[model samples]
Target chain A: MAHDTTIQTAGHDEHHHESPVVFGFWVYLMTDCIIFGTLFATFAVLRNQFNGGPNGHQLFEIGGLALETALLLISSITYGFGMIAAHKNEINKVIVWLGITFLLGLGFVGLEVKEFIGLIHEGAGPDRSAFLSAFFTLVSTHGLHVSFGLLWILTLMVQLAGTKTIPERMMSKLTCLSLFWHFLDIVWICVFTYVYLASMI
Target chain B: MSEHNTTSSGESHGSVSSYIIGFVLAVILTVLSFAIVVTHSLSPSATILTLSLLAIIQVVVHLHYFLHMGGHSEHRWNNICFVFTIGFVSIVIIGTLFVMNNAAVQMMSR
Candidate 1:
């Protein structure tokens, strides 16, 4: 098939250029930025509307957020390493780095779920106040994205394991996922700063 | 996508050093933002300003090292689209805040 030859060319060629597919992915990410920006605006507007409920300073645990931040940041770099390995045509190393990235991402989502459950148990659920509603909507949206990214990493790992060589289509897919994974980390930085740290101060 | 391969070369994929640099800088900024709040080393306004500045810087760093977006010809369209989107996003966020906060102020005063 023509597809098979394209994959062979992409696999064997050095300094292969990214196809238009990557730019298309970037366009999608840009729209995602708008979605997050609107959410951030909503959170900003409602942050002070505690409705007689506990505020962020009282509800957020800095240590836990720091741990989540560390997990996510580390995972971003590990995914970068995976991309580098992919470029070097080391399929096994790429899979290994991706596996590590998956675990770290899972850890991040786990801590987020724990925090959400704990908050709900303590009556700080989204229903409690406008502030909490905005908080839950904004933060959980990011959490959901991470969960999806974890699923993506898993799917890719399974696909990579079955193949001896990364096909052109596969490499492009990996590149898009790498961008997404790093993009999430970037969003988390904003979340940590504005939502958590700013609230603390 | 196939047309793109024939027309343009790919952007830089990033190196290990670039990744490490981005990670270290991100960690530093994160710790600094957290520390500024925890230690209460600055006034409230100053802390917010500093955190916002740090976050912006960290974002740029990630865009550069991780995303491999740069101010080069190869990335011209990507940069243009990014700036265009960011402009609209700023309008959305800042405009909403300005209007809503003003409305809140007026309503609360009564």
Candidate 2:
């Protein structure tokens, strides 16, 4: 039981913990990073492969992307706040901060879905050209990550709400989820800069 | 271990100032990248270079400030993993682009 607690109990130090869970989660995130790397590389190749359809310059709207960028970046900070709250074992504050993070995430995804639907309606759907396909795949994969993150946050909230004490389990989960949220933002920086801005210029 | 003591003392939670600094730096870099593009202030190559440079900096900022990836002794392995991931990711991206673009040029020319 002592070994089990040491192994499975939650951690607040996050990156400082010796538990395999944190290390394993970090490895998982790196693998996920490789996945994004491959996607970005694919986008790089096909970016100019418009095949007579509209290119990114004609299709991407900077205003929406800029807003989306702001929302996600802000949410990253908000999640940081949530993590800090978790570290202090301030459950209510953690909930409030994470709830705020969730809303920002939802807003960002709303804008992304709007962007995709708007593109498809304009006949610039993913199937229209290689460029569009790659763009859609890369951006939507990031968006899917955001969607999953929101779901994860929601579950964490539910679990935390019921628990009287802030369990190490909940903290570990929060730490991993926070790492993931920040990772997505880092990827978004690349996507917006390379995929959207680079395409434009 | 000293690392365990420091973390147990709650020093590892990362200061609010750090998060604020990271947030501000990230927003500035993001806006700067977009501004360069929207204004067309630089040549195409320069714009791409600047954006790429800023993107790299922003990722580092997130890792440092938000992710608590400071050079803590206990986080030595996580730091190594991060470095390795960056290396791997760069190789994949650069290699893919190199191979595909070369093949693409030949195919198009032929």
TM-score of 1: 0.92
Q: Kindly list the per-residue Cα lDDT of model 2 for residues A78-160, writing each as its tens digit.
A: 99878766766778999999999999999999999998999999999999999899999999999999999999999999888
lDDT of 1 by residue, B3-30 (tens): 1111124456666666787889988988
Q: Which residue ranges in model 1 land beyond 4 Å of their true spot?
A: A1-15, B1-10
Off by over 4 Å in 2: A1-18, B1-11, B108-110
lDDT of 2 by residue, B21-41 (tens): 788899888889989999999
Give the range where candidate 2 chain B is weakest over 10 consecutive residues by summed lDDT.
B1-10
In candidate 1, the residue pairs with backbone N, CA or C atoms under 3 Å apart (3 or more residues apart, or in different chains) clash, namely none
Q: CAPRI verdict on model 2? A: acceptable
Residue-wise C-alpha lDDT for candidate 1, range A175-195, written one tens digit per residue: 999989999998999999999
